[model samples]
Target: MKMNTKGILFVYTMPLVLLHESYGFFVPGYPTKHISVSPQGKLLSTRSIPSTTTKPSLYSPSTSTSSLALKSSASSDDVQSITATNKLDSILSKLTSAFPFFVLGSAILGLMKPSSLQWTNQGTLISWMLASVMCATGLTLEKKDFTNVLAKDFAAVPAGVLCQFLIMPLTAWAIGRTFLLPLPDYGPSLFLGIALVGCSPGGTASNLVSLIAKADVALSVLLTSCSTILAAGVTPLLVKVLVGNAIHVSGWTLCEATARVILLPVLMGMIVNAKLPNLASKVSRFTPFASVVLVSLICGGVVSQNSSMFLSSKALLPLIVGSVMMLHCVGFAMGYFVPKVGLKFSEVTSRTISIETGMQNSALAVVLARSMGASPVASLPGALSATVHSCLGSILAGYWHSKNKKGKEESSESNKKDFTDRPEDDYPELLI
Candidate 1:
């Protein structure tokens, strides 16, 4: 038994001592009995190793050097991994923060390429995508949602409509006359964009903005659908009335083309959505991607169409300023005052109105420009507005999202306190 115990101690302690001692990791009082210094220099209590262990009469201080070398090697790998992970996280956050801006920039860059603007097979593809997006937008509707909106009997509903149709159109006209500085070749495009907004129904993105602001979602959905249906007729009429001469548009011609391109497709989508709800869902799922592709193609086409104009730095200021001012004023004003007139809307709904008014169906405007025989310069306002409104609108939506979250938290807390104060014995009575 004694011999076996000594053999076990020797087996365990000899390897540890040799491995650790070369690096000066010492197990104190160890020469007298079984003890071991681990690679990290901690004294480990081991039942497997016996007591009264053998030791060299002359022990060296450098016995644990190999262990130290191993630990040093492993630490370097851990450091490298942490550094790589930090860099990856930074890159991801930056990309996420800048995604909206990047999309806007890409649209602007596409405008410079003029080749991207030419009407070709690709233009038809964009048209089809626009059709699909309209269909997806239509899929979310039910007849009841509209009826519910009608039921509200709130003045804000009609007020919102009036602001969209009347107030905004006037605002556009005023902006174009005052700021854009009339030019025969390009001034008409600026006016056309404003007219497009004056005529366009609320866009699909308004529903998303309304959701973020915690506004009346059903009302927003109702208004958007109805307004879109109205837009088919209204857009052409308003464009003819306001900027018809600017583009030399024949009212009937513009109306017919508008009906074919914008109204017919939207009405068709709505009909399809009503009859084939399942197909609507499957297609609507791709609306985001579809919208992106369509916008890209349009912007690209516009760039290609106006490549020479784009190459001139002198024309850059008018294009940028005119587009920005038109979108900014129309969107910001309608958003601010429309809710305040006669009917009271929560801050959220107010924000939604602003976004909805500002973000027109620029795609429709671009298509209309093509039909009008207007230069690509005329479509520039619409293309640039598409980019600006999306970025600004997203920023505004994010602000409202934060506001809604705070309101929800407060409401939840109040509910919790209300429950806590109720009598323990009166739970059933409270339910009754």
Candidate 2:
């Protein structure tokens, strides 16, 4: 229901903090040592050793974390500490690292407006960005990974895909019929909303989000890989079954469209990744920012064009809110449940499914909708999904983070209790 820029802002800003810390800047307790200059004010080549009698200087990680913490805690103009050089260096570092994402976002923004480029021209830009990202994904992969596609894990892939392609679509359809059908002319948009969820792939951020939530990282990756590989085929079929009539859909048409816009790019990336791993690696590094920029532009364009439909569609708000909530919940649940369905959802896999389901490829939805010449209303589902997913994912991940923290605390407390209650003489080995 909300556009969660918090993650994007963090993604854009964290590097700055890291850069500042790495550069011996304003960050406190960051191991900055003083160096004396010669009388001529030139830098001294030789460093003086401290007296042997001096105590060893303390360096604490807590102190390092706390020093950055201080910067965040300060009141306006209350500047309690920090060197001007360090501050400037820190600021500069942040700016430099964030520039690429900024520029990419700006370029996408400019391209989204019809005034910015011809219709034919836009395809090249989208293709370039997608191709670049795919290449990146390809570079990181090995033939060994695909082996899993044929192994026992293969069934899990379909199980997970079924959840995405089957469960999610059905849920959306039911919700639309029950809650959205009442609104006149909103029928197609509702179907469009369901299709948007049905057609999306696992989001790139799912692994990290799963980790943040303290879920299974490996399982998350596996499910994502399975679901994504199948998305190109499965997404369209699901859409056809759910909303074919409402949107004048044809299975072959959707399938071909999926192959071009989604499948081919992915396969090409895989091929490149297999053939030139180094090139794939280089491109992968930039894909995260590039993908974000692409999605942002696509969403912004949808919003801009459909501002009226978004406002007028009475079911718009509920549809957005309900769809996101349901999709996220279903993802998390299926990730958990399906693992238990004989695939053995490792602690990590459950976490992975939880994240993968929640973060769908909403950008693809927008691109697909726009490509189909669907109304801006049709694009609304994608835009709303994009806006809501990021925000909801963050909140969910934060919740999992908090739970993990609490679990650790409880375990610590239990350990302490046992230690305190034990007799040292009875179990002396425990003392070690």
- Report lDDT (CA) for all predictions: 0.56, 0.54
Q: Model 2, stretches more than 4 Å misplaced?
A: 1-132, 148-155, 311-315, 337-344, 406-432
- Quote the lDDT for 161 in model 2: 61
lDDT of 1 by residue, 293-344 (tens): 5565565556555656766656664655555656566666666676755356
RMSD of each: 23.4, 12.8
Total clashing residue pairs per candidate?
21, 3
TM-score of each: 0.67, 0.63
Candidate of highest TM-score? 1
Q: Residues 52-99, candidate 2: write the lDDT tens digits.
A: 322221111111212432222346454433333234433333343332
